[model samples]
Target: MAEVDVGKPLPAITSEAKPFWEAAAQNKLVMQRCRDCQAYVWTPRPACYECGSERLEWQELSGKGQVYSFTVIRQVVGRAASMAFEKEIPYVIAWIDLDEGPRMISNVVGCPVEDVKLGMTVSVVFEQQSPEVWLPKFKPLVS
Candidate 1:
């Protein structure tokens, strides 16, 4: 992992999401799973999105998925906040359909932005944003 851009916005670690961030720092991808319904929960919710069960536990994931949708960011949009990514204009942001059934939005890296396609297979790669934060970005999965 490389040093994060100082201008890049970092995630605020909430108690519910602390575990996920901690795991990412270890270069692992994990999500919460409901013990009662066997459903995977994302975004660090308080209860299962599927069965409304509060019996959730953190579990490691395969870190593999397919691009569900994507867009090439060619311009900086917002105010000061968007300027941080100005150097990374023309990056690809995509929704990935994980093998474990969760759809997560993350940046697709390790390849040309033009090469990204819908349903293209990808796997997780951590990018260190800070000592306690590592973002899970996706890259093209090599066979």
Candidate 2:
């Protein structure tokens, strides 16, 4: 995978989200799961959204999912922030429904933007953004 440009925006590594980013750096996908409710929690939240449980554990995921929804970005609107992605104007951003039961947003790559479709199967691919950060993008699954 190609490294992200230096000017591209990177995620802020907070204490709660450190593990998720760290796992990505090692080419693994992980999410927080509520020990009480057994529900997967996203965005590194301190409590489970389902049962409001404080017992969350970091668990590795299968990294396989299907596109739940998507949109093609054909334009760059902003000056500084958006310009960073000008070269990749036509890209697919989608909400992927993980096989383990969580919906997360990521870019769907490795194919033409027009080829992306709803319910398309996908798997994780990491792109190193910095020494400590690897952004997990997804690509269409190869059958």
Candidate 3:
């Protein structure tokens, strides 16, 4: 199944990825945690990214992290080019190292693109791109 149109291509819902997307639709950030190694699995693989264990369970995240890396998207290309995104030029895309040890590739919103920096503290904000998809974004965590 597919989510509502967010003016961009939605992710293809696979059997393995269904749980992750389902939690997002409910405005929650979740990842697969390996039961054997106790490691969080990203990318929704069938096995743990750490110990290659198949015993995995869905776990919610605290939504706190630091900007491990970032880039200012001055332009969009390929499937990313859309009218909705055109108005969001010069956005900040970043790799956020979550407090739970997973790094998420997401956009840094609610701040100027130029203000985004490496090591910046951030917290999650769910953007409901469509009714069935709440895209996880981050913003600078205010002290």
Ranking by lDDT: 1, 2, 3
Q: Model 1, stretches more than 4 Å misplaced?
A: 1-5, 80-82
For model 2, the stretches where C-alpha displacement exceeds 4 angstroms are 1-5, 80-82
lDDT, candidates in the order shown: 0.92, 0.91, 0.88
Tens digits of lDDT, candidate 3, 16-121: 9888888987778899999999999888989997888899999999889999999898988875675667778989889999999999899999999888989999
TM-score per candidate: 0.93, 0.93, 0.89
| Cα RMSD for predicted model 3 | 2.6
**Candidate 2 global lDDT:** 0.91
Clashing pairs in model 2? none
**TM-score of candidate 1 relative to the true fold:** 0.93
lDDT of 3: 0.88
Residue pairs clashing in model 1 are none
lDDT of 2 at 77: 72
Q: Estimate, for each residue in 73-100, the C-alpha lDDT of model 2 and write its tens digit.
A: 8877767435568787788889999999
Q: Residue 49 of model 3: what lDDT? A: 73
